[model samples]
Target: MSAFLDQLQQYIERHALFKSNDQLLLAVSGGLDSVVMAQGLQLLGYKFGIAHCNFNLRGEESKADEKFVRQLALSFQVPFFLKQFETSQLAQESKVSIQMAARDLRYAWLEEIRFQHGYAFVAAAHHQNDLVETVLLNLVRGTGLAGFHGILPKQGNVVRPLLFATREQAEDFAKDYILRWREDTSNASNKYARNLVRNKVIPILKTLNPSLENTMKSTAEKVALAEKVLARQVEEAKSKWVTEGQGFVKIDIQGLQSITNALYFLHAILQEFGFSWSVSKKVMESGSGISGKIFYSSTHRLLKDRENWIIDYREVAKFVPVSILPTTQTVRLLFGKVLNLKLLEGGLELVTILKSKSSVLLDYDKLVFPLTLRSWQEGDTFIPFGMEGEKKISDFLIDAKYSLFEKERIVVLQSGQEIVAIIGCRSGQRYSVGQATKRILVAELVFIG
Candidate 1:
């Protein structure tokens, strides 16, 4: 076996990436690294198939790459899967960079194909230099310890058997085997940040330290080890600070402040929620007065409550205030719920309002047309059932045994300065269907989840 193949075999063994009998699905871009990996895996007598992604960014060039990969698979008489993506459009829609979009699209399709074909593993050609480049990119992007941990050899069913090899080794293997592969012109272009790092920054860095990739790889592994230790520590710290609920976490700021290097510890906790170092520190230093201060991630949120930090995942269905019209019989509410509004014909006493809180009978004459359905806010006052005076919406939720997520999810039906109903909860006394009521509006709230 060649030295590259020997190294790959050792890397696979060391990482325990896959079993001898495991079928593999290889991600091949028709590049030198991937071609070398495919050649090496074939030489090792491993049963595998090739998969290619045509990103459609380079038009004809993308097709050429796909064609080369298909031919390469056919030369080995292996099953080949070809997929195309509108990478730019995907990026725009996902609000991510084209590179990120392409990576996401490629992996998703690879996993899908792997699952369907009963492939035990999906292998990618991410070599040593690529690992170093990723760490450098994450460093520039201000990523924390986990980011410096570099790429994993195995993540779920995806494995990187060639991760121990370098770019130069890959090129040498392709040349020594007389293997042909397509070159992407985009690699030489510095338009993308990664391309800039590869072509411009790495060369200068390599001049100073010829073995930078190996050196950085060692350093990254150390960081990964440190991250593992920190992760254990963070878990203990979370036990002290974070109280996990149905869909949210309540972080005790007071509990965190007692620890040494609280800010650094806080960063580790907030990192999972995608909070930046600055924001994490801000979350640490924020005082009790900033109760409403909110830090947002793409999929989650951290709210600064008086003595605690509130971390919550965003609802799949967004909360939007749909107009409640008189003619409308039913309206769709957020999170798979429905609001049914109907006129109560005759029997309209406040006795029925107390029977079922979910379905409220309210005075139709008291409610104004075109009422709005919205989430509760601080200081929003309504005469809650059994209460003579108005109570703050926040206070009412606290008394309702509502969890943080439930409190945040509570919707209020409003008409002018009054709350017509607190949907899915209590009835507003101002709109209560009293014994003297002429008309009654039966507002029934149906919760889907």
Candidate 2:
């Protein structure tokens, strides 16, 4: 064995990613690096199964690669698994980039098989060159330190034993073993970003320093260490500022500025609220004190409140109010804010207006015939829902800390021209149940604040 292979063997043995009795699932693409990885693992004496994905992008070339990996696995008397994918179609359907789609499908299938067949871990051939290229790509794309962490030796159930090895090292081993590996013609085409980096960018750098790949890989290792420290800081900041309530989290915008990775911290916070990258950016830029101002995402909305941001579930279903036929039993209006109802008090027989309030549970029997629930009006006033006197619908809102915008859109319950309930905030104290009243009108407002 060559000195490089001897070192690689020792590196794998030291990691102990796989045991003598462990079964590993290796993702092979019939490329030089993967072939080297498979062969190297075999030499190290670990039992493994080879899995290949034929994305069908290269027509006959893809099938050819699959055939090579299959035969190679057979030669070693190991089991082989192969799957064909219509990657382009799936990518379009999923609204994701083709590369992302392929990755999602590949690992999803690997885990499924691993669970079914009892595999220790999924292994992929990600050599040092791939790590350097990935770090550069993410840097050019405006990524934070976390992005520069690059490929890990192991993530969850997937392991990359060859991450410490360079492409040159893998190619040298392939040559020494007399291994035949098929190369994808597209790799030389430069149509893909990674291919362009591999062919055009790295070559230019290699000219200046022949050890550019190794140097870049070493830099990635240092960046990974720095990124870990930054991640811990972000986690601490997140715990300090974010509070969970019911179905949403309240983010303190002012406290976020203290975090070193503010952008990453905001991104992770939005992610926890089910927002995507585009929506997360919008929410971050919206700043604070933007009450009722809303930013929409695929799955949720970031709603601004005083001193905080709220992630609200944007209900896709239309609000269809249930029909309520007037009965002696009081009807609950789920749609419109105001409920127009009649109340018969003492024999004095004064016009009483019932409005929405927290404590005003109206007597279902006292609500008069043909009560209608509808939006409030400009002249709306109710004996302020639990006070000794009447107050303008607008003035009641001001007392409740409702923003100016909320005052314009609030629905008021009216009986003819008289204001009854204000949906949620308060009801007319005049219409409240009193002594000597035979029955009471129950009108309540359910507020989705």
Candidate 3:
């Protein structure tokens, strides 16, 4: 066995990545690093299968890579799994870069295949150079301390067995073993950030430090250790300052302000909610200035309120005004709520029905048929229940102390041109069930799991 294979075996054992009896799904791209990894695993007598993803980004080159990986798998006499993806189209659909789309697609498929085929781990061929590049890229893109750790040896089911080796070491091993591997021409191009770092930036840095990979690898390890400590601290802080509810998270402004480097702590607290550092910085700076300033991430929105920062899922569904016909009994609303419409005899019990916010009683005779149930709009006016004067919906929500998210989700039941009930909150005076009412329309908002 070659010394490189021995080193690879030692790295695997040291990391306790997998056992000899354990099955591994190797992610092979027919590149030098992956090819060397396959050879190393084969020589070490581990049970593994080759899995290749043809992203279809390079057309003929991508096909050639798949062909090469398939033949290699046959030569090794192991099962080969291949998947093709329309990466460019997927990138557009997902609204992410081609690289990110490809990464997401491959990893997801790898995990799926692993579970289907009963593999213990999915092996990736990321070497020390990749780790160094990732750290530098994170720095360039302005990441937090977690990014400084670079790629982990084991992340979930994905294991990097070649993380102890550099790119040069992999190339040398392939050459020494007379191994054949396909070279991706794209790697030579400096268009992608990773390629630019690998082909141009790292080389420049290596002039000053010959052992740049090892140096960066050591730095990454130290940073990873520090990250663990910071993580514990952040968790403790979260326990004290953060409170999570059904669909929202609240961060106490005073608790956050008391921390040293409050902005950093805020960023740490908000990162999991998909808030960017810049957005967190803005939230930190907005202290005690105004309430109702909103910040958004792709998945969540943060609201600066009186004493807390409220984080909730950003509602993406566009509200089309739902038409409520007189015959209709049940209608589905946004946010897992169902509106059940029922006509009841008016004289039974009006006081009990008026108290609950989730259900409201309105005079069935007063409302026009085909009422519009839609999100509240600005300039919407209604005479609130027990009031004689018209009040703007906006003013009512403000007086009721609705949060930014609550205001966005508030729906109003409109009879002809006038709003009869602010759903789940208040019924308009025009539609109130009174002594003169014969039929009562009960609109109760039921929450579905």
- Worst window of 10 by summed lDDT in candidate 1: 346-355
Q: Rank the candidates by TM-score, best first.
A: 3, 1, 2
Error of 2 at 19 (Å): 5.0
Candidate 2's residue-wise lDDT over 366-414, tens digit each?
4443545555556666777457777777677767876433444455544
lDDT of 3 by residue, 1-449 (tens): 77788888888888788888999999999999899999988888888999999999898999999999999999999999999999999999989999999999999999999999999999999999999899999999888777898998888899999999998899898888899999999999999999999989999999999999999888888998898898898888999999975356899999989998788788998888888888888889887789989888988888998888999887657578899998899998877778999887764366574557698789999889899999988989999999999999999999998887778878999999998998888999978877888888889888773
lDDT of each: 0.84, 0.71, 0.89
What are the RMSDs of all candidates, in order?
A: 5.7, 6.5, 3.6
Give each model a TM-score.
Answer: 0.75, 0.74, 0.84
Better of 1 and 2 by lDDT: 1
Model 1 Cα shift for residue 254 (angstroms): 1.8
Compared with the true structure, what per-residue lDDT tens digits does model 1 show for residues 1-449?
A: 88888888888888899988889999999998889889999999899999999999998899899999999999999999999888999899999989899999999999999999999999999988999889899999877777787798888989999888788888888888999999998888999998889988999999999999899888977887887897788889988888864346788888988888888888887878887787777777784465677777767888787677888775445578878888889987765578888875665544545457578777777788888888888889999877799788888777775656567677888897678778877788767767778877777887665
Clashing pairs in 3: none
- Candidate 1 Cα misplacement greater than 4 A, ranges: 92-95, 287-290, 313-408, 411-449
| Predicted structure 3, TM vs. truth | 0.84
